[model samples]
Target: MGGLRRAALVLVLPAALLLSGCVATPQEGITNSSSPSELIPAPASGAPTTSAPLETAQTSNKAPVYWIGRSNDNAFLYREFRDVPDQDNPVTRALRVMMSQTPLDPDFFTPWQNPKKLATSISGENVITVDVSADAFNSNVDAAMAERAIQQLVYTATAAAASAGLIDSGQQVQVVILVDGHTDYVAFNHVRLGAPTSRSAGLVAPVWIIDPQEGDSVGDGSVKISGRSTAQGGKLHWEILKVDADNAKTAYLNGTTTASTNAVQPGLFTLSANLGPGRYEVRVSQVDASDSAKELFQDTRGFTVK
Candidate 1:
């Protein structure tokens, strides 16, 4: 993103939310409040257009929603494909669920409170406009977490738009958040809103388990596990741990495998193991460069085999 400069709201809707009367100023030394709307600058010259209906845009019944989760003792975004209501606008549907529903994985959660009203629309410039009620910004957080929370919306909105084919994948996608159609509101008492936000680099988990989502069940015998990593498809260490009735874990399997560097999604890896009926955990990690024996950016999933 380029240096901070004021951006004019080019598109205007007939009915918009009332502007917030409260005013907030960013505290000095807080870099998170800086604006980066240029990352998804408005197109040179194009009238903003709304997204097509679900019948024309949606590729599947599922919408991808990103949630905030802890990994390696730090917060990062994790995604899950959730079923969407038929005929509903995919982008707004996903955003509503993201703010209101509990994540399938216990480790993932959203700081947002469900707004009274929510809506989304895409522009010819590839910017997604998310007009959510002011109630959604009720959660209190620090500057760093607040920044991440806003990015959480950025990631979810863009993802939803992409999954529904509302925007072109080849072009950069950004999200412009408006509370009830008004801008310049402070979010969570930290980050300011109304800026065209893009996904902040390095805010996603380096490694995340995509299958057997936390607390899943599978059939006995051969079980397949897979995940995505950003380690440049380098060697990854994997292990399976069997949990006994006493809830103690016993090492079941361990090995080293390389993620597919050429995968369309990048760093995609898969492995399978044979096991009798039991509860088990699959963990994957890369060796810490400074300490080969220590694991770095580890991600794990628990599942039961019937």
Candidate 2:
């Protein structure tokens, strides 16, 4: 995640219409380009390995939005969203970081085929529309999962927006899904929409990679926890909490324990502060600077170190 990652081709799906933010336009059916001259980022951004930082802005007293698709990104949301003057929303920042992380690869794409990446933007409305590139469809994601992936993005952004506490209660934080500037189920081959073509949850392999799931058992050992939380025993990071009473009281736990690293997975975490005979509490919270505690998605299992 430190270095730049490689780029991929687009994944076009004729069967699955608008993935999420992509709305169906009257003319093209789906698109992020509101104008003909809009310059959509080549999804490559060159090749980003880590998560991309999202642009945050102060709340605006504007009307609610119904769609956040290609047209929306190019027309309304591009420059409108900004960071709060001096405030720092860690949650929002974390969302931005998660975005730049390794982008999803294309599905069912051929070696010779060139796929396009989908880029989205949000402005006037809370919606972030995406122009499903041919590359995305070609990525070979599951017909059913494609829509889910798109929807998850919408949910993530909305969660961030809600945390920012911007906009009004009248205007709901919503994210519309779109595909290739249109909102119709089609394949990379440009076939008409039909029955659910998605074989299962997705066309691409759903990965739950934990960079360092297991670490050294000895306290002197280099304990580095990682791997996909979605995987079995994936949430091994929070199993043990070291507590050293002699150490800083403000610290969360004892010994040298790694903090929870939310690497684009879903889950929660709790701490164990039961200082025993020789054990002492060091750090109190899971948020630490070592693992860059921004936003970690992990399964939460409460435990107290006996």
Candidate 3:
């Protein structure tokens, strides 16, 4: 909190919705059977061809369609870092460390999904609120999971704000997350942890690497962008945005599905996109399945196809 001034408050969210059965993932990129193979081909250098419907588009014809990058970079980050934040910044350094170990669930992340949900503020005596969702305490996520989640907010926020930093470190950080907001049913169960709290994970890296391993150049056909997540849980959404300029540099689309629970299990998703030939930024977000804060991690990698 020394070098930088704290922000008043900020919020962020995930970009996803519920799915019926299990979400299908393409595997042309990764090794998981659950994921689908992405179809992202290299854009070709040529003039636009406005051909009439040769053979009406088919329902099953998987193709890679290229488009333009509507917006650049993460909108949430743009707001927090670029926009005017309160003098007391409450999300910095340490928080990134905790998230590296265990990513927050995208389902609960509110900022992007819900702009109003504020995680912390600098106006008052550094008020901190932690919201828990229904799936916050899944069978697999036990004592360690709960402990880490709390610590992440505490360490990260305190490090960002000044007053919050003065607050008692040993005292528990107050949180007000929902148990089951999505479902009509609600069950509140206490998540107990071992006596001595373990130290949060060391500075963790949230970057993911996505690549089009499948033979490039599927001209207006199904291609693939394969890569790996630091861990798992977040669904795999894709975007193929193609930016048309004097330079055929940027253009692509995107697709994704969380790899948690039945709706979006830990796996892959196959999508269809078309590109002529150009540069692309394949952005993949890895949000936890339970954390109220979504977009725990995002990987925007560059790729080229023949």
Which residue runs of candidate 1 sit more than 4 Å off their true CA positions? 1-59
Candidate 1: tens digits of C-alpha lDDT, residues 1-306: 011000212343332222234344556634333352213211111212111111124546777888888866678778888887754466787888899999988878889999998977766677778888999988877676777788878888887777666677777776768877777767887677765666765677666778888788899988999886666546678999999889899999999776665635556679999988989988888655455687766787889999
Give lDDT tens digits, candidate 2, residues 191-284. 3222212111111111222221112122322333332221211222333434345432233333323322344423212333333333222211
The C-alpha stretches of model 3 lying farther than 4 A from their native spots are 1-207, 213-220, 246-252, 260-272, 288-294
> Which portions of model 2 miss their true places by more than 4 Å?
1-100, 103-119, 123-125, 163-171, 185-238, 241-270, 274-306
Clashes of each: 0, 95, 85
Clashes of 2: 95
- Per-residue error for 10 in candidate 3, Å, reads 55
Q: Which of the predicted structures, 1 or 3, would earn the higher TM-score when compared with the native?
A: 1
Q: What is the lDDT of residue 156 in candidate 3?
A: 42
